[model samples]
Structure formats: structure tokens, C-alpha cells
Target: MLDDTLRPAPPRRGGWAAPAALVSVTLAAIAGFLFLMMVTGGLLRWSPLPPGSPADTSGRVSLPAEVGAPGIWTPDAMAHPIPAAAVLISGNTWYADDSEFYGGLVGAGADDYRVLDNEGAAGMASVLSPDGRRLASGDGILDIAAGRRTPYPRAWTDREIAAQAWSPDGTRLVVTSRPVDDEPYAAPESLALLDTGIGAITELEGSSPGLDGWTAAFSPDGARLAYPAGGRIRILTLASGAMLDIPTPGGAMPAGKGAWTRDGQGLLTVAGEHCDTCGDYPVSWTVTTLSASTGAIAGPQYRLDGVYAVRVLGWWPSGRPVAVAYAPAPGTPATLFDDPGTQAGLSGLTTVGTVRVLELTPGSDHAELAAAATESIDVADDVLAAGTLRDGRRPLTSVDRLATGVAWFVGLTAAAALLTGAYAVAQRASRRRSPGMSTGIADSV
Candidate 1:
């Protein structure tokens, strides 16, 4: 107290330290939050949902459901249960509860679901060979066409069953069954030419290499069969008994699903170049005369973009120029469904004489119904070629295609950004406490 030279140091108030520290921490947190908001918001904003998305909102994951048997509704085959084992003429006529199994080929175009063992459906029976003639329908089956009844092989034959198809002449049934039995034709997959006329089934010798499945399609002339084997395009000659693999550019041929051209010269892919998952599906596909007889890729690969689920819109009687229903690229200046009436009239795709063209209208979305095909889906080229096209033919938008891709990326990008920001925030908190622990925070500090 007596020393005048000692002056007290300025007071460092406790309040000052607490406020300053708090302000600094708040500012840091706000800055970090803003940085995160800037990056995360913009990053995911550009994502878009793909076109043609299903009802699934859980992203690509699908949940399984247990449903009871669905009803079988059909005009031709009503008062009976369509066999879960037979070929269904229409998709609407089968059990919704069961997965895709054909209504067994029976009845005057009707049949019951057959069980294996050739006994009553209670027995373990598989698909019967394409038998045109049957006096008594197999258990749970019916008879439709005119054919004599014959007994199936006693022991289960080696033949593997495939999706059924009609031959060009309608005399034979082309189904993808290999060897007609398990022993001789071990290749479990082959296109079998069952001669309904002569009652002889010939296994087409040269398969398009690895081509399997019931998706095997035949041209109307009974000459060529187009199939995808081992993810490549190939054509088989029914007449010549030859299978030639088509050459693709750069790498391998597209392994997408394929359909025949009207003339049977070209094939359509369900997806195309951008569709990596679908293996090249597409809206349009044509097999031009661009290939040599040797089956080489000669001209530009013709394809239409953004279409799927190609149904038999119609067929030209001349055997060329099929009528296909397709929508335009999803977002282009196009309308959806093109009225369900609109059809693409294609020229060529036939060996018949006159130019094979679709009967399209100028202003209307629906196809200009040809006078000949007015009664049915098959339009005769001769009757319609000289026939004029209706006015107002315009293309519609294909909704499903673009949506598929857009939706995938949108979800992916959003999830990525959100997860990234979450990780960043967690890392900042750890850094404030530990200073240098995890590599992520340690580097930042």
C-alpha cells in the first residue's frame, strides 16, 4: 500500500472472455453451415427423376408382396380355371396371383392347368410338346384346334420348353425347346421347328450361338429367325439350316431384346446406346437390306430412341412393313400416347411386290385404317398401297423411356450430397473436441 510505483494491471473481466469465445464459436458454426448449404443444395438440385418410373418410392429397391390367387377373366375360357402351365393368348386372361405361366394349350382354344405326371393336375406334370391333335384334353386342359390325340412320352422327355410361336406357313409351331428330349439335345435351349403338317419336330441345327429362351422370333416367310445369343445379334436360316452371327462395330453386337422387321430383314432393340442396364432397349429398330447375305453390318444401324414394351400394334399382309405404336422422346415437343390410335406406317420390310408402307393419317394421331385391315390387326399391303394416307400424322411423346434414366440419377445425386454433408458436419464436431484424431478432421485443422 505504501509503494506508489506499483500500479494495478487493467482488469480482464470474466464476462469479456465468455462473450468473445461464444461469438467466435457461433461464427464458425454459421460459416460451416453456410458452406455446407451452398455445396449441398446446388449439388443435388440438378438431379432429375428418370422417365417411366414405377410406383416404387424406395428407390431401386423392391419389396416382395404375398398375394392370394388372382382371378382368370376371359370371354372364350370363362367357367374354368386356366392352367398356370399353358400358353396364354392374352395377358388379361391369367391368374394375377401367379407369376407369368401360360394358360395350358387346351380347349377349343381352352384348357385346364395340367400338373406333371400326365395324370390329373394333382400330379407333377410339365408342359406337353406342341401337339395339334388331341382327343381328350390333358388334366386341367382343353382342346382348341383339329388334331388327333396322342400320348405324351412316358418318362419326362429331355425337351426344354420355351415361349410358343407360330411358323410363317402356320403349319409348324416354333417354340424354343431343345433336342425334343433331355438325352440327345443336351443344349437345354434350342429353337425347335415342330412340323404340325408332317408331325415331325426338327431342332434348328445352328442356333445363333448362345441364343436361348422362348423369345426366339421367326420371319413370316419361314426363312430366317433372329435371336440374341451371348449378348450378340444373329440370324438363322430355316431353309438353309445355317446360323450366322452378325458383326458389330468396334466391340460386340448389342445384346438387347430384338423383334423382327416386317420383311424380316431388320430387328428392333428394346433399348439403345445409352441404356446400359437394359442392354440397349429402344423405341425404333429396323433391319434394312444393309447387310450382306453373309450377315455383315453394312449400313447405318437404324434405331428410334425412347420407346419400350413393343406390342404387335399390327402386321401388313404383304409380309412386310409392320405397324408399330411408338411415342416420341419423352420431353420433346410431343404428346403422350399419340391417341392410342396413331401408328407408324413404315415402308419396305417386305419381299412382296409393291412398296410396303404403313397406313398413317396426316392430322390424326390414330392410324388411317386401311380398308382391308379394318376387321383385324393384319393389314394387306395390296389393298392399302394404292390407298392414300389420312392427313395430320404427328408423333406422340414416349413418356416411360426418359423417366427411367432421369429418376435414377436424381435419387443417386441427392443421396450422395446429403450423405456427404452429414459426414462433414460430424467431422467438424469431432475436430472441435479432439483437434487431431481422424484423418478427415486432422487434415482440415
Candidate 2:
């Protein structure tokens, strides 16, 4: 028997250690769970299936299998394939692009699509003259009646005229140009004035110094030009080089060239707004008009009901706006790019539907949808061709990328905390089991 005087002390339980570790584990787990949710949410956002496309629980868009093309649809020249750019319908005739490739201009006054045989392979931005006698394309003016080309002088032929709009009088042309193969004019010195009568080329300098030039439309009276840049439409005076900026509503930037109202009092274009609360994808866009004189919003944002992915094409003769809309069966959400944060306020959505012309009428407070665009998967391309392809398609804006980065950081931090807390608890338990530890037990002598 061991001596009574030499009794071993009892091992003391850590009074605060276990409970503190448990508390840490609980808090860390909660944080980690929140972070996990954020990461999953980001992934789901760009998944190919979403609430607005195809068939969804939202019941906005649902279609049968025999409807539009599936994953990828082959485009045909005879059919009105999705227009690659600008669309204009005047008189009884409509002109539109049959493809993005060269010499894709097609025209139709009747139901069938016909190739504009007189169109050349130059791929210049072409617009019909006021009298509708000729098509002015780039530095080369195409005389439809004569079936001949009037080339600009060698001195006037350096720049690639990307976009041009004829003045109401047809004597002047407001042209936007870039390098030869650069489809969208991105250069700072892209604006120029062309005097058609004398072939005089005057380089103008009123475009946004901070942004690349997109769409340019001459005012009805030829006194001003309205174009979109950096979330606003700028009206530049031809005589004084003065400029006025009109901001789009809901902080959405103007997309495409500003479409002039018949009275030239308002400018129309598609505008987009970002939504953070939207689970996977976070952008919503619609078409609206801005008053030229006062910069006031003329109406509510017009969108196709249940159609989330739509791009403004231009206006029709009946005063309706046309757009290319995409709707697929709802599934997972996915985007064109992993993230499209640099595409200035673009929603970064890829569509699978057809073009829609909305019949919205202006009213006292806002515009009302007089008649919804017909849901036709196929339509012949008539009277709506022969201009620069100004389809407003782009990726995400910088703001969207910033939001993604924030979500990732919070998730990572929470995961680290959870892991560290678990490691600390294990270390404490291991220390308690070491041989050097003594138990508080008495030994009888």
C-alpha cells in the first residue's frame, strides 16, 4: 500500500476551456454557413437556367420543344436570322441584316426576304437618303438607281466610316469612323462631318472624351446630333460645338444610338439597372425615352412581360420599338462570360428567343403597352436592313465584378475562422491526454 501522506491530487476539468471552444465552434459554423451561401449564390447566378429564361416557376416564359432552336440554331440567308446590327422600317419596305458576315443586307416590302443585289461587300454603315433614291455607305456612296459607287477622294478615304446619319435636308452626313476592321468605333477621334455635295471631310471633336463612340443620330433639323456615352445621351451642336448630357433613369446607361421621336423632342434607347437582391444574375434592363429639352423621363421602363433577355433594335413606322428577346426553359443560371463586369451596365445574358416589336403608346404619366409584341419564333426580314449592326450586346459592367469580389472575400474569411476554431479545440483535447498530467486520487498506506 502506498503511504497515506503521499496521496495524488485529482485531475481538474478545464472549467472554461470546453465551453469556450463550443461557443467558438458554434459562431464559426454560423459564419461559415453564411459564407457558403454566398459562394453558392454566385455560382447559381450565371448558371444557364434562371427564373426569366425558358420555363420557370415564375410562369413568365415557357415553350414547347418544337418552338425556337435548341442549343445553337443554324442561320439561313433566306430567313430573317437575328440581325447583327441596326434595323429600319420606312414606307412599306423594311431592311435588316441577314447575317453578321459581309454583304448580308436584305430587304423586303412583302412577306418574303430578298437580297439587296446592289449592296456591295464594303460593309460600310449605309443609310437611305431622304428622297430614298440612294444608299450612303461609308466613304463610298451607293447610288441604288444608277447601280454604281461614288468613291470618296483619296485624301478623304483614310478612316473607316462605321456609322452615318443623313441630315433631314440630305446635304450633310454625321459620320462615326474607326480603323478599317474595327466594327465598333472605339477611337477617340471617330467623329467627322461629310459634305456630300462637295465631298468635304471635316473632323469634328464633340464626342465624349472619356468614352468610345457608339451610335450617332442627326437631329431632325440638322442642328444637333444625339449619341450615347457613359450612361447619358449627349446632344452636340453642329455650329458651336456645345454639348448637353441627359442621364438615363434608374442610373441605367443609354444603349444603341438615340432614336429620335418623330417630333425630335425625345430620344429613345434601352437602359439597364442592376439588382443585388436577385439571386444568381443581378441585372434587369428595358427600353425608355428621355426628353431632349428637359432630360425628363417620358415613360415607365418598357419590357416584354416574362422576357428577361431583350435588346433594343430600333423603332418601327407605326411608332413601336423592336427588340430581340430570348427565353429558354428555366434551369440553372449561366452567362456568356464567367463574369461580365466590364460591359458597362450590360446584363450579360444570352438569349434563345426571337425578335419582338412592342406597341407602347405615350400617355400622361407614362407609356402603356397598347399591344404586346407577337410571340412568333420565325418572321421574314423585310424593309429593315442596310445599316451598321447596332445590336446592343455586351458582357457585365465593372460594378458587377466588384460585387462578386466582395462576396468571395466574406466567404473566405468565414471559412478560415471556422477552420482555426476547430484546430484550437483539438489542440486543447490532446494536451489533456498527455502522460505528464496527474489524476486527483488518494492512495492508502
Candidate No. with top TM-score: 2
* Candidate 2 accuracy as lDDT: 0.42
Lowest-lDDT window of 10 residues in candidate 2? Answer: 63-72
The TM-scores of all predictions, comma-separated, are 0.36, 0.46
- lDDT of candidates 1 onward, in order: 0.32, 0.42
How many times do residue backbones clash in model 2? 35
lDDT score, candidate 2, position 162: 41
Q: Residue-wise lDDT of candidate 1 within 1-445, one digit each (tens)?
A: 2322434444433433344445545555555554454344431121222223221222211111111111222112222222212121111112222212322222212122111112211000122222222211122223333222343233215544433344444454544444543433312255455565455667653453322221355564657766555544557787777877664332222221123545555553322233333223333333232242444543333333343312222233433333333232323222111112221111001111111113222121323232110001111122222232322111011112223333554455555555555665675575467533222212221
The most accurate candidate by lDDT is 2
Per-residue lDDT of candidate 2, residues 1-445 (tens digit): 5433434455755555556567656766655665565455432221221112211122111111111111111122223222221222111011111222222222212111112322211111445554443455553665533445677656645655543456767787766655565543333345677888998877765453212213566665678877655556678888898889887564443333325665678776554445555344454455677788767877445643344344433454565544444342245233221124333211211222223333344421222211111121111112222211222211221113434555675666566656666777787787667655344455775
